[model samples]
Target: MLMIKSWIYCCLLTLPPILGLSQNLKQEVEKRIKAEEMPAIALEILATHLSQASKIRYYKETDIGHQSFECKFILDRLWYSVEFDENGAIEDVEIKMDFEQIPQAALDKIRYSLSAYDRYRIRRTQRQYTLAFLSSDDLLTMVIKGADELELRYEIVLSVKKDGSWTTYEMLFDQSGLLIEKKEVVDRQTDNILYQ
Candidate 1:
């Protein structure tokens, strides 16, 4: 019992710094919300701009530092999710995709990056649209028309085996599949399950 107490004390003192030093952990929680609970403009934007989408569901997502609203649905047989800020301004749109759907160049780069691991499995993949280089309306239009006018990115959740241990990672890649960021997923065995 004394040894266990000492070990606990040691962990309490050392854990914070260790966690802070690792800039590569992802944590989030999401809960379902009604359309009325979200910003009015968000629903208006969806009703006016993305009317073609079906089976829409709303969620309030809380991340490490911020919160956002999300609308997930099926659009033209593709599963898409749109995220909005608290003010209802568009943030990004994500389209779930299969490995075969990713561009060959991006796939090659992603493959090379994961090769360092003993084994890896892609858990989730999404093609993302954002207003980084354009206006929110323009980004929304791109979603409507399926336009590829701007640079593209891929967000992936991956489980990898390294040094005989398995860890989950959240990775972002540019259109060419060059890794933009790589973070370990924390809080749960995986990142937040946005929905069932």
Candidate 2:
């Protein structure tokens, strides 16, 4: 009996993350934070865009083992999320938009890839901008002008089935729809002490 239990445990540990056995699956947790909780450097960078931004909100986001601060707001009739690391260094900025915002070529490629699955539905779409050493002003300029100098990527969250079970995945693709990374999303439930 002891040997059987040990073997089962070992097998479970070795299962792939997509099988829902891994503890470190991609999960994002966000909590709204006040200006006092934000780092000065991050605030300094954000000041440049405050003139045109409305409905601005700050949040601290945690995903897997990383933590970052985010400023979400509306600018130029578009929703934006600017992220910064613990040290207030800019990481990347994301714009929330519909599938129609994606370029035609990229959209075609995305559709072609989705055809591989039996069926899939896109739940969310965000365009990511990453450019190293770009000051906040420069970043805002690029965003406003729709410049192509920045690295643009698409993050698509969709649900697909495998082995008779459905799972959610976050797929990252380059501007041309070339896949950069794919990760399975894990559902994390809040603890309810009353249930225990």
Top lDDT hit? 1
TM-score per candidate: 0.79, 0.76
RMSD to the hidden true structure, all candidates: 5.9, 5.9
Q: Candidate 1: worst 10 consecutive residues by lDDT?
A: 187-196
Whole-model lDDT, candidate 2? 0.84
Candidate 1 lDDT score relative to the true structure: 0.85
The deviation in Å at residue 141 for candidate 1 is: 2.0
lDDT of 1 by residue, 74-153 (tens): 87898989999999988998889987689887798889988999999888999888888777666876776888677778
Q: Where does candidate 2 stray beyond 4 Å? A: 1-26, 162-164, 187-196
Residue-wise lDDT of candidate 2 within 1-196, one digit each (tens)? 9999999998777776648666654568899999779889889888877788899999999987799999899998988988889988777888988977899999999888877787787888999987666875577568767887787899888898766677889999999988889988765454674465
Least accurate 10 contiguous residues by lDDT in model 2:
187-196
lDDT of 2 at 57: 97
Candidate whose TM-score is highest: 1
What's model 1's TM-score? 0.79
